[model samples]
Target: MKIVTKRDRVSLRRRVDQGTEEQRAIVQSILDDVKANGDKAVLAYTEKFDAVQLEDYKVTKEEMEDAFASVDGEFVEILEEAAANIRSFHQKQSSQSWFDTSEDGTVLGQKITPLEAAGVYVPGGTAAYPSSVFMNVIPAQVAGVERVVMVTPPGKDGKVPDGVLLAAHILGVADVYKVGGAQAIAALAYGTETVPAVDKITGPGNVFVALAKREVFGDVDIDMIAGPSEIAVLADDTAKAHEVAADLLSQAEHDARSSSVLVTTSQALAENVQTEVEDQLKSLPREDIARRSVEDYGMIIVCDTWEEAIETVNEIAPEHLEVITADPIQELGKIKHAGAIFLGPYSSEPVGDYFAGPNHVLPTNGTARFSSPLNVDDFVKKSSVISYSAQALQKNVDKIARFARLEGLEAHARAVETRKERWK
Candidate 1:
């Protein structure tokens, strides 16, 4: 970690990775093949990329039972508790159909409808993330979606990870598929012979998956195109050096492009955390990845005041923000941008990632400025309802026609005019 005393030297923005033309071309070919050939293309790509041939891609009930049996009792208990917390949190975000009736016999409101089906893509190329199963599937279930499908690549042995299966089983999501990469995304976007197409897709994946989602966005809705992970800690003199260093490293180990930054008013705290990060990096299991991340993107920015520190954090718009100041609560309202905020020393970043109720699928790469975390709302659609009474139409018809004609939309003006005479 590099420590800087000058405020002008701090920069945390990372370049978003939009895959190369070659990669884009490859993803497009796979999407087209899956769109045209459906199941056959998916199977061929699975054999080529995942190195496995499967006559059937769906995970059977027998396989689910085997996976459930493989997981220990204690881990199952933890997954249940996490699922309960996630369900409770997302249930609050669910909305109902609402209509506001006016005295003039006009009705207007919004109708909330859950999608018929939703797909969750879990990554299994490098490591299996059981937590992602809980984060993605639980929200869709809470939104009252009729069907929730999960897709994950099979291992070289042609079996999904036991932990991923256990998590889906606990959530009661039985439609699990043993496929991944852009091919799985295409299968989800366009219905295959076996895999069902979904109204929306959510979850994080590699560059190929991201590009696939981008290409099929118009035909079906998708969560934001996520980038690498990021964490920004705002601390003060009262904050402990070791705890802050540990929190920063939690995100640094996620990927080589991951960024961990600290902005503080205490010069001593900044210098201490810098040394502590270097010391702790020696012991991390993912030391090589974490070391490269910290070496290239990590920073310890020393600001002259708390205001400067807070402003710097807002500018970065990190995916995760930890406030470990003397008064974390007082600084909460000042934070205008962050996908998720973890306050105090005890609320480490990992708590939100796994056990805590908040959704871990958050916006990254400064997108927190405009986007938001995955929630029950992502699985549902909103339709605006309008019911115009005869009295209301008669009152506003001329105004509407004049406004439409002003825009040079003669047909729109006539459409309103024709309705006015019928109502009159």
Candidate 2:
């Protein structure tokens, strides 16, 4: 790992900060095609890219049943537990429609209404993340969203992941389709002959999927356009170097683009973690990805004090932050920017990503400065409602009429003025 001295490193975000425009153009074209041709375009892309032939895009009841049988009972039980935890946490975030009445007989307030439908895109071409199924669907269910439609790429034998199916079942998501990539996003944003259009789309995939979500955001509300995974650990001599190294590798294994950084006050701790990372990488399943990430993006900064480490952390605004220090809570108070903050040694990034109640779909690539993790708010919308009795309208009509006329909206002004005439 490269060592960055406080004097050497630039303010950090001096790094390459935006997606390639070429990628944006390619994804935009895919989204446009899907919007125009619907399911026909989606199926063609799936066959061309994923190499899966599909007679029908929709997964049958029989396929779901078969997927359930293929999975172990123990894994299914774990899914149930994770789903329960997710639902319990999101239930607290749920809001209800409310109204306020005045003495003048006016009733006005904002109403919180869940989207009629939500589309969840599960990327199946590269890897399966059953944990993501819990993250995307559970919040929607908690927000009282109706008709959750899910799409995933199929295997060579035309079978979806068993864990994905079981997770969908646990989250009360009945609709499943075999579609993937940007085309899948288009189908959800715009109605297809086979798949119904959704009011919102949520979940993570590759660059193509992220680009697709960005393209479809206005047409159908989307959770976020996620980038690469990242984890920043702020540690002191109190933290176990081995555990810190292992946690860093865990996130680095996500992809070569993924970043894992350690900011510590101890030069000895930094050196120990560097050695531990090499030793631990020998046994990891995705050692090549982790190794490449560590070589290129990973860094260990030996700072003068905890305050210097925190200053560096705030500048980075990493997607995941693990604060392993003498007092985790006290250190955490200094952190103002991070998608999610892991309190201590036991609360790793994967803990929140899988079993923990919080949503794992976090802001990545330094976006935590302004963005947030996916939540119940992503699935529900608020609308300001206004109503007034005769007396209330009579008193407010002149003001309303004047405001509209000031904006050169004659019809709007007339509408309010007419109400005043009726009130009289």
Candidate 3:
């Protein structure tokens, strides 16, 4: 990990927004092809990029049953428990339609409507992330969306992972597809012959997938333009160096661009953590990827005071923040920006990633400054409900006309004026 003082903050911010124009162009081409050719283009790209060819792109019922039987009974029980926790947490986020009525005959309210359909993208290749299946699906289901579609890349043999398939079956997601990358995103945005168009798309993906989502934002609602995984640890002299090092590396191992940072009041603890991270990285299986991440993006910023450390954390607005101080709870109040916060030594970031009810899909980079995590609200739209009775319209007629005409909107003014005339 690179050790530095708080003065390097400006340069670090620039480094986080780095981009590649060539990658964007490639993703655009794939998106264009999918939009024009539909399922034919999707299959061609799947064969070209994933090295798998397929006639039919949808997962069959037999495949879902096979996935269930392949996994052990113990694993199924654990996933069911996790699903229950996720569902319960999201259910609390569900809201009801409300109306406010007045004796004067004005009815003002909000009506919440779940999206008609939603598409979830799951990255599939060598590794399988069944947890993602649970995290993305349950919230949409809780929001009362009717059709939840899933799209994942197929392996060399052209089959989705057992765990991914099992997770879908457990959630009762019937519409699963065998295509991925930019093509899948395009298919979801605009209807393909096989994959139906969706109102929204949510999940983390590679750079190509991110670019595809960015290109199709207006065509369909999306969660966020996700960046690399990142975690920031705020600690003081009282915090243990080994635990701090472990937490930093947990995010670093995700990818070479993933950022892991430590801001501390004590120079001694910073030095100890730097050494501990190096020691731990030597044994990790993804050492090459983690090492590059640590060398390039990992940082340990030593500050002169707790106030300075907290200020630095807010500037970064990291995706995940962990506070390991003598009073972690007290430190949380001082933090104003972060996607998800893990307080104290026992409340590590992984707790929120897996078992905890909070959604794992969060704003990345510095987007936590303005955005939020994926929840039930992401799957629903709210409409304002307003009805004016004759008495109400008669009372407010002149004011409505004056306001609308003042803005040069004669049509708007006439609509209210005509109703008011009938009332009078």
Kindly give the number of clashing pairs for every candidate: 0, 0, 0
- Candidate 3, clashing residue pairs? none
Model 3: CA > 4 A from native: 8-10, 13-21
Q: For each candidate, what TM-score against the reference?
A: 0.97, 0.92, 0.96
What digit string (tens of lDDT, one per residue) describes model 3 on residues 1-424? 8788897554454333323888888888999999999999999999999999899989999999999999999999988888888889999999999999999889999999999999999988657988899999999999999999999999999999999999999999999999899999999999898899999999988878888988999999999888889999999888999999999999999888899999998989999999999999999999999999989889999888789999999988999999999999898888989999999999889888877788889888888999888999999999999998888888888899999999999999999888755643
Off by over 4 Å in 2: 11-25, 396-424
Best-matching candidate per TM-score:
1
Write the number of the candidate with greater lDDT, choosing between 1 and 3.
1
- Give lDDT per model, in order: 0.92, 0.85, 0.91
Candidate 2 least-lDDT 10 residues: 10-19
Range of the 10 consecutive residues with the lowest summed lDDT in candidate 3: 10-19
Q: 1-424 in candidate 2: lDDT tens per residue?
A: 7777776765543233345899888788888888888877888888888887787988888877887888889988887888888889988988888899999999999999889999998878557878888888888888888789999888887778888887876666778888888888888889789889999999888778877788787888888777778899999998899999999998899888788999998989999999999999999989999999898889998888778889999988999999998889987778989999999888987889888899889988788999988999889999999988888988878898899989999999899787655644
* lDDT for each residue of candidate 1 in 135-159, tens digit (9 for 90 to 100): 9999999999999999999999999
Give per-model CA RMSD.
1.3, 2.4, 1.6
Q: List the residue pairs that clash in candidate 2.
A: none
Residue 14 in candidate 1, Cα distance off native in Å: 2.2
**lDDT sort, best first:** 1, 3, 2
Query: lDDT at 196 for candidate 3?
Result: 95
Candidate 2: RMSD to truth: 2.4
